[model samples]
Target chain A: MGLYFVAKRFGVFLVIVWLAATLNFFLPRLSGDDPVANKLMEQASLGGYAQAGIAEMVKVYNQHFGLDKPLLTQYLNYVGNVAHGDLNYSIANYPRTVVDMIAEALPWTVGLLGMTTLVSFALGTFLGALLAWPGAPRWLQWFMPPLWALHAIPFFLLGLVLMWLLAFQFQILPIFGGHSPGAKVGLTVGFVLDVLRHAVLPSLSIVLVSVGGWALAMRGMMVTTMGEDYVTFAEAKGLRSLTIFMRYCMRNAILPQTTALALALGQILSGAVLVEVIFGYPGIGALLFQAIQENDFFVIQGVVFTVIVGLGFATFLLDILYPWLDPRITYRRS
Target chain B: MSETILRVERLRVAYDHPRGVVRAVDDVSFSLRPHERFGLAGESGSGKSTMALAILRMIKRPGRIEGGEVWLGDTALSGLDTDRMRALRLAGIAMVPQGSMNSLNPVVRIRDQIGDALADHGVGLKGRALAERVRDLLAQVGLPPDVARKYPHELSGGMKQRACIAIAICLRPKVIIADEPTSALDVVVQKQVMQTLGRVQQDLGAAIILVGHDMGLMAQFVDRLGIMYAGRLVEVAPIRDIITAPRHPYTRMLIESLPSLEQRGGLRGIPGLAPLLRELPPGCAFHPRCPAATERCRSEKPAVRAMGEDATVACHLA
Candidate 1:
């Protein structure tokens, strides 16, 4: 059943990616400048060519970049390149393949953002369940207002404050970067420790700024689940309060959040571009930002395609797993 | 006389409302005998459910028993803490709640829920023995043995009610309280559920307290009947007397309001709603709505008076 579902969703996923790639090929041309014209403008800006020389330059550039081919033939070649795991060179920046550039930066963003989100989700959900218990302590209820205040604060501002206080004032840790200046990259424990040390400040900031939202969301889920008749029935059946909390309430309360998590998974790969820029993390978000500024169309297309495919896969996996986690759900093909 | 299993004496349950203390159950009392089916018949807001919860100490915030001793055999249930009360409840005295269709967890199989109650008491029954016992319970409730393997959602409304009954009786408790167990089912299904209850009570010989608004059904099944009007027990008598020789005007009206099986239409419902607990009238709560109400009935609340044949009526005329 699981294999069949995965195969079916994969078919749909491929069709969606194909449509998106087709759009990518046509969309840049709609901006009203051919690659030959762009090349001509560059030569004119450098003041190195007269009109006749610029025309010769344009012809050479067009032939080299395959802009001389028919539109349909160029589109087919682009699709074939994508199929062979070949993301061509960035158009306006460094001549690195878009694939290699993204691969180099992908790990830093995923490691930082993924770790923060998982930790925050766990802590927030546990505390929310505790607070929502019927006879929960007053202090926990009192804790909610401050958490809400933190939640209302913007993530960027929170990251700035943490960087100033913990890094600048205390001189406790490095403020930015994926690793310390002298650190080497390898499978060694020393390299891993260096990466962890550098990741601590920005990751902690992200977790603190985001944890309150999840805590508040989970508290709401708990409050709603607490009122469900099954919870009451579980209580009436004489299951211990702790067992009821863990088994009955949490199991159901966590379900709606699962979809949110699936949606967030693709976005996590991009990370916070602003935060990464502020902290100098070598991640996809920073590269994407640079790529946007330079109009690196090939790299941008590759990044967008990867993010979309990641989202589709995450949602597909979640949909397949939901029925196992919650027996109330059953998969039906339309 | 059968041995008395539970005695609720001078029970007064009140809630702290915005308008002061609203007495939801006012000076109501009754005793249940072993194997006797005592039915409390009243419309919504009559405090029938409140009285049952009070017996189990299941009433939480806002609602409280102001004056009462709920005696299960010799042990006072009302004074016990929540842990002990929960232990006694369902293991010693269980309730088959209203809306039985929604009572069971839709995700869980029927056998697991029944096993859960048994497991709560630190009892272990597993493998063939567990399956056999669940099958026996299913058969006892007139359900197919394989029905235990199905989820509650797969079952019909009446089947869910029977599943509820099966779970309730799994402990073999001394008292079983069923609140409006058949209200949501079809006529034929209602008969089957009620008959299943009768059969379970007979087989277990446990004291049964059946709460319902249907007077005719209550008359047919219950050995004793207590009629509640506006949270007070206005009359208690044999089912025959309550149905044929009702003393309180409220009881009489309630009985007359129900249609006989032969009567096709025009069942006269009670003219007014049950008195709101928050702002009850100064005298008898039912006086404004009672057809035979006198001047004194609107001026002073009546007290319970013993009639012959072990019956009691709370009315000025009586």
Candidate 2:
């Protein structure tokens, strides 16, 4: 990869993020329902109050949120604010900024989903490689059907089942939430251990469901790679079985798998929505879910924009790392 | 050193398919003297490459070494365990694989590719020593020392083939099998690579079994030649004898098929296609294609018998 290539890829990344942010800004507004007005109306009806002065309240709220301005002006202001890392404030949770909410939830999402995705990728890739390898144990073939079954089921559904079996029936683990209800949030070992304990069921469900996909993809790649002339030549060179398996077979096969992993990691924020909701883990997915239910446009926009940037960043890193992974991949303009 | 460095005794290789077992290499026997160049020439699907792979005990799945033993020096390759066989490979008997374009790992540097072969076989060279050895190997193959730092894709087709040859000779194996090693190269580069191969074989005092369909190349490079038809070696003789007074009818046709400056005429190819291994003709596999096929040649299989001190032919007419 060259400097020019890096610059070109970075330029593309910026354009993509900007396009995504613009789409995010316009999509919800196109729904034609004023989330602020809707929230106020729902609140008034729940409290059994008259709907009088609702128009006045809506106008006041719109002005305060800078929504009273022309569309272009509002778009410009939104882009500027986003550039400065200010996501304004949540519509439903008025006093709380979207940035604040995201900051609190981002770590949990990254910790849980990030860890699970990597573990599943590594474990699944190895298993998949072994599955296709002729020398692998015969018993490994037995893992195929069960893995496919687990992969077919949605992670949230798997989470529910695991929760029902382990948490509800046997009570072997915490049923929901990120930690014990009364535990203090800190860097203490006890607190960390408690968080990990709560993370177990959600991570298990995710790892189980996703591992099969990685394995299947890896196995396909491995099979094709195994047929490559280089692998045969490597064997003819009399390399150790382990060396051949790792360097020649798995090394080449893992290139496409790494690309998938980067994409998967980028999608982790949005993908964790259902899993986090089920586990009651305070991650961005759960935050986005709560924001959607309450019609908090700022939080939704903030979360979505963050995911777009993350995905673009992931691909950008992939571009930078690609030349290293496979020497044939040159980023030269030609 | 023994008179014969590598001896392949009654080697048989079969592929198990849904329809039937395809005998790719059937009871083929040959041997190589030290510092000798033995060429195995045959048309496509004639089990020449299979015999070469079987010699290395590298017949892949669905294909098994059904019978016979490959003896490199005094050691029987079949009796040894996989680790032992692997150890013997590149150390005792290395192979310059066919399809050199994709033989070297595309991502790996030439130096590492060579170094790994050395390292795996317990060469124990590291850092500067390994680097120097790799450069030396590259130089010996007529490649620039800088090629050691380049990846396979960075090198040209001929360069890649030379790199493969470099790797094959890295361990100074007793026998090197060049299986159509220059099949993918043009005539010019093919000649250069073969010369490089010949030079390396001489330097190492190792015998070479050159497997290819090019009779011209075999005649030029090899001391002796074996003609394979279907799944059998129909003629095994000195190159000069095989080319000048070919014994088997198939060998005669193969020699005649080669274009010559001396006789300018229409090209002549063998009359029929090589028989399918699964359903070979009842007699000699070459009988259908043989120009001098007789009633006995069509009905009875001819065992390989010595016709003279220097040659053997599996033809009843001979």
Candidate 3:
């Protein structure tokens, strides 16, 4: 909560990001697969080129990308380049830089995943709180079975079902891609509407499958919090039912839910991988999927590095905000 | 007494168990005069706390006020609707709570907690006025004004209990139920908190029902004491008369069980445990443990009979 505490938390964040970057640099190399050689061999096999000069071509390409350097030297250079915000070139998409690709794809992922995560969290938390509340309507109990059923189904499977029903059978929403195939890419109302329409299916699947989890966790917390003595005292104080429900019960119960929200938000880049792939939305999840399939090492490293930084930053913000949420958590040493 | 401030007649609180209905507080009756300090003392599971909660119509689900009437002045609390009952609480009657450690919301500040009770009861105090009222309430409970900014955890156990008392007296209800209010504090702090409660009660002229098991504290603090056993009140008498001449066998044994400094000897304990409400003896609930229980006591329930001035005992021999 203090400047010193914030500085200390930022220090921890830097250390975590550095460690993640190092892991990113080493993990792909540890896979022991020569991506460059594999690409050239596949091209040669397809084009019916002689295999004799392929070794020479591989050597030339390795030198060009500095892969021919010693492992330690390559690591040092990678770290130095990362410090300068250069993520190197993508092997699959040869001339495009990883940073450029990420910049182009990051907004779509953040917009869709971020908005959906918040919406589901708020909806699920409120519903869950109501479910545990004795004063809530009896009809709210009927939602339990259906919510659990939706939670049990995977988002990607739900995505496919929705696509089959709404997109294929009913022909109501778009089937795939982030926008219309040849629409003019601008900030026009038509362009934004197309993007939103495309986002609907993926967002729905994500929210539906994930809301149950949030609701279940929140309900459990609410039940426990409701049993707390403070809640009874609040009622004894003659507070309005709504006041006791929100300020006394839901307020305490929502603390752990906020923690979960932070973790969920941090994982937003990776969480939508399957859903994005299913819907063919032009988000980071889809880009990461493609990168993984094509063995694009630089792009994969960049995506993973971004996720680590995002998570560290999120937890950092939580640390700063936690004292405000629960006053007992003080930064000053006793 | 000019007139009773609060009267509870034949209050029955029962819990619906799978096997049978458990009468936690069965046909218990008592009354408190204005500015009176009445104590309800009994062993664990003796329905003291249950009756206290029943008085406020706060018996939770699975347990309910099966039949009874709690009258505060001209209003019958038992017949009031939910909204009316809620509004009456903390203004008509308030509770000091049994568990002070968790009675105050841990996440909220003391100022807001006290302010909440005031604002809910239509005090209409805001900003500087609210803060001033909170600080005054805290000071009345012997707490520092700075305690208003602190959370429950920041304060000590006794301090938390004082804060609870502060909230209870914010609207100066006619009746204040301090249910085992000091059960969690050290002996030293317990005395201080009780003294604070006494001062606040005198200032408000509110009748208090101090529910606790500490007979020594009860003898010192309460003007009158009621003994409960197996969901029933066995005796109700003035503190001095009960201490000097306890008519009911259970009351006499409970008084004898208290460690006395002048009589240095082995601690005296009652012969048997308090009876379970679900399977109590047909006649007197305490007959099983009564040294002088007779055939009449074992077969017929004794009605509360009048004793010498202002005392009542439900013992056939008495």
Give the number of the best model, judged by DockQ. Answer: 2
Ranking by DockQ: 2, 3, 1
Q: Which residues of candidate 1, in runs, are more than 4 Å off?
A: A1-6, A33-67, A92-95, B124-132, B261-266, B308-310
lDDT of 3 by residue, B1-318 (tens): 358989888999999999899999988888889999999999999999999888888899899889979999988986789999999999989999984449999999999998888877788788999999998999999999999999999988999999999999999899999999998788999999999999999999999999999999999999999999888898999999999999999999999999999999899999878777889898888889999989998999999876765678898988
* Share of reference contacts found in each model: 0.33, 0.85, 0.85
* Tens digit per residue, CA lDDT, model 2, A152-233: 9998899999999999999999999999999999999999999999999999999999999999999999999999999989
Off by over 4 Å in 3: A48-57
Q: What's the residue-level lDDT of B205 in candidate 2?
A: 92
Interface RMSD of each: 2.0, 0.9, 0.9
lDDT of 3 by residue, A1-334 (tens): 3888888889999999999999999999998999999988888889866899999988998998899999999999999999999999998899899999999999999999999999999999999999999889999889777887999998889999999999999999999999999999999999999999999998999889888999999999999999999988898899989889999999999999999999999999888687788888888999999999888889999999999998999999999999889988888867
| Candidate 3 chain A least-lDDT 10 residues | A269-278
Candidate 2, position B52, lDDT: 83
Report how far residue A150 has shifted in candidate 2, in Å: 1.0
Off by over 4 Å in 2: A48-55
Please write out the lDDT profile of model 2 over residues B24-121, one tens digit for every residue: 99888888898999999988998998898898899988899999998888999889999999999999999998844489888888899988898899
Candidate 1: residue A165 Cα off by (Å): 0.7
